[model samples]
Target: MPIDMSVWQGRSDPEDGNKGLRWHQKVQPADNANESGIMLLGFACDEGVSRNKGRTGAYDAPVAIRRALANLAWHHEAPVYDGGNISCDDSNLELAQYRLAEDVSRALRQRHKVIVFGGGHEVAWGSFQGIGNYLVQKQHVAGNANEAQQPPRVGIINFDAHFDLRNPPGGKQSEKGSSGTPFHQAARFCELHNWPFKYVCLGLARTSNTQALYEKADRLGVLYKDDHELVHHKMEQTLTELQRFIDQCDYLYLTIDLDVFPASVAPGVSAPAARGVPFDIVEMLLEPILKARTPKGEPKILVADLAEYNPRFDIDNQTARLAARLAWTIARAIR
Candidate 1:
């Protein structure tokens, strides 16, 4: 029998075709006379998790997501530089992630808006570190030493399957990046750095969180709203409040766990949410931020990354399409 090679087709030219559509330019973040709004980044999550055990082929998420996003061509006016996927080889996960985050920082420096396709939620650690570093450096250059601690204004918005607030299920303080703990690690970093944090977690009604997680959230004062609460309340009103929260921060970054969408809508995520945010609700909740329309001389923004897409579990790439579409919506509306 002869070996097949088409399975590796996308690997060689990851940026070529997205959702069967061609993209004109998919390169490093750039600044041009046309003055585009945001930079688009994509990546696979952590390095070593087995595909079957975790989320099927989530490692290939970046490519498929880029393809999906590339297909839309709706936000054509937005200046977009496809920074490509972060190299997620397990041998040096941190370094790979840091390099990718550095690319994100570079985009921030150029004042490009960002929406990253991803590997797993764990990449948030490095991404945050990169953004925080940029904020700190810029403040020093501006001679705001006294306000450096607060220079990098940031907020948290998430739609995830779990709170990810568990504190060392085994009592160890820190562990290498894992799907189950990125939020906790990220919160710790944000709190230590004194960044403006209005952490609002949405679509997390299903989880195996223990009492310890609740106690931890209590201690930290994390603001989380469950699916039920989101359903009964006016979504637009709640999103208005959420926008106000992000407006208070100097830098804004959002993380989307594919599982926040119902299994029917986004089956490609790491954990498919049995009951997830509807397309309309998700759109409404994100409208304020998407319609931000911030121009130059305004605050430089830290990019948003969409993580944890496992196409092996997807239904005809529907979830990938939705996630990519959502990324574009946010990009167009970003300030």
Candidate 2:
């Protein structure tokens, strides 16, 4: 569980520095007592992609994203920690996924804002596990009620090309989950923990998902918007809807699958979008949510992850850079 520090090299010219010091120079361990911190945990696994029948190479995303972020200007004062990575082999994906959960939970307990970069969309399930556990622990500490006479509601807002609601492979016998099934797995996880699953998925491409998947989403009560509906005129309405969902949740988990962006912008993904949502549009929706606070004035976005960044298929590192920009936006936005 060590971050490959080799990726931390970039331009450094202090005096004549428009191409100056980068994130790698600014980032340090999240061991500060005076300031809130951000922890970067890499999930380097792509077995879920194989199971979901998508292209591989998502396993290499974490480091690529880190490298991309290394050259960005450090706009935030909070300390950033490298939590290394949870690597998965073909035989031990389950173990790796579980370990990721443990690391995320520990980070939450330490009060570090957790930002996980991933190997696939499967990263969502593990990240959600940690966030869910943290909230449950917080509730227990507060005597099981948050002044609302109920446990805090947790919501998931996913920006993706697909619903990722595929059922466990072959129904019952092969219960192994895949990238396409994380949200479905997450919904079940919620049910088992007595937590309500308030999932809102945006940027879905109708052509990318099947009828059965749509049916599955409906059955699971997933609130989603198709890619076609995210036009300029509908942007405000979208945020209004997003705000409505955010109001109900005590905590929130935001996930971005890079494939949700147009293929020209993010071609290096397991599945690229033909007509994806633009980056600016996504920012409009996410910025307000990231800036939001809970009833107690705490940051509502407890944990977040960026997934589906495949360096193998990228053109001139476009996708990795885009992913890094998103991470930078989150890091700078968080308190």
Candidate 3:
């Protein structure tokens, strides 16, 4: 049997914020044919160290987020392919998540966009492989022409509270992945693959990061845009800096870990920043990004992954709903 995706009712098409849209479960490929455009690969991660490892509910996240998003089918025309979730269990922990990563990577090679829901931010590594593979293949195809090397650059923009560049911190294994280490692993993995990348990390709070991580990021030439710096400087200047990062990436993947948001806006995050990037600052900074047009004249940003939404710590699922609106902003970028 061929892979058939799962598609919940997402407004049947994007419409005016479909607040009243009711969600019903539906499997994709209603037949076994390949349909294209932005594929919403709904993956969940449960291995990233949970506050409660004994309980595997974080794995339930993608299902919840998907349910919420389906109700707000604001992106009516956005092509969505729900490649379902990998079961997170003991024996297949690595393989389950690895397959999720592998599937996402393969989809990316085929030029399908992805939005990964989460058990944790650790899934960013898989998402990175998928997007990075696309850029690297194109880079090799162009083959050393400096101008060719300049094909629209591909970048990864991470919105988080910590720098997440810890180098196994003296080779300590996470036993399983840690919520604190996805970016760290992502940066290193790309380096090992010989793929030079453009990176912009926004809302990284100093409180949660180690000084060494800052040094490492500098050594790697990664652009670290923290909340404090953006707040102190003129907002336009900050946005300009973001554009420079965008300039390097032909294919861009935006990863927004909810931890980057303040306790006020998105309190459901496991690690909220002490000083949030005021809601307005985040809006202004991302405006240009959301407005970026693609080679086909649509939005440039394609895949995205949002992690660390803990409803137990949340207020009325406000975070998910708010994220839905933000997803709308991103989908608008696509069209």
- Leading candidate by lDDT: 2
User: lDDT of each prediction vs. the true structure?
Assistant: 0.64, 0.86, 0.64
TM-score on alpha carbons, each prediction: 0.81, 0.93, 0.80
What does the lDDT come to for candidate 2?
Answer: 0.86
Rank all candidate structures by their lDDT, best first, as comma-separated numbers. 2, 3, 1
Could you tell me the TM-score of candidate 2? Answer: 0.93
User: For residue 181, what is the lDDT in candidate 3?
Assistant: 65
lDDT of 3 by residue, 1-335 (tens): 34333435554543624443333322243133175555555556556645223233456667667666766634345455566666566644456557767767676666666677776666676677666665666667777655445443557788877765665434534434455566666666665665665678888878777788888789878888777876845776877788877765666778877767778888766665678677677777777776676667756776777777766566888777766666556655654
Greater TM-score among 2 and 3 belongs to 2
The 10 consecutive residues of candidate 1 with the worst lDDT sum are 1-10
Candidate 1, which segments miss by more than 4 Å at Cα? 1-37, 48-53, 144-151, 168-175, 232-237, 292-301
Query: Which parts of model 3 have CA positions greater than 4 angstroms off?
Result: 1-33, 51-57, 73-75, 91-93, 136-153, 169-177, 293-299
- Clashes per model (N, Cα, C within 3 A): 15, 0, 13
Q: Looking at candidate 3, what is the lDDT of residue 45?
A: 59
lDDT of 2 at 205: 98
lDDT of 1 by residue, 117-230 (tens): 777776666677667677767877776546434445567677676676655344436545566666676676766766545566777764545667767766766667666557
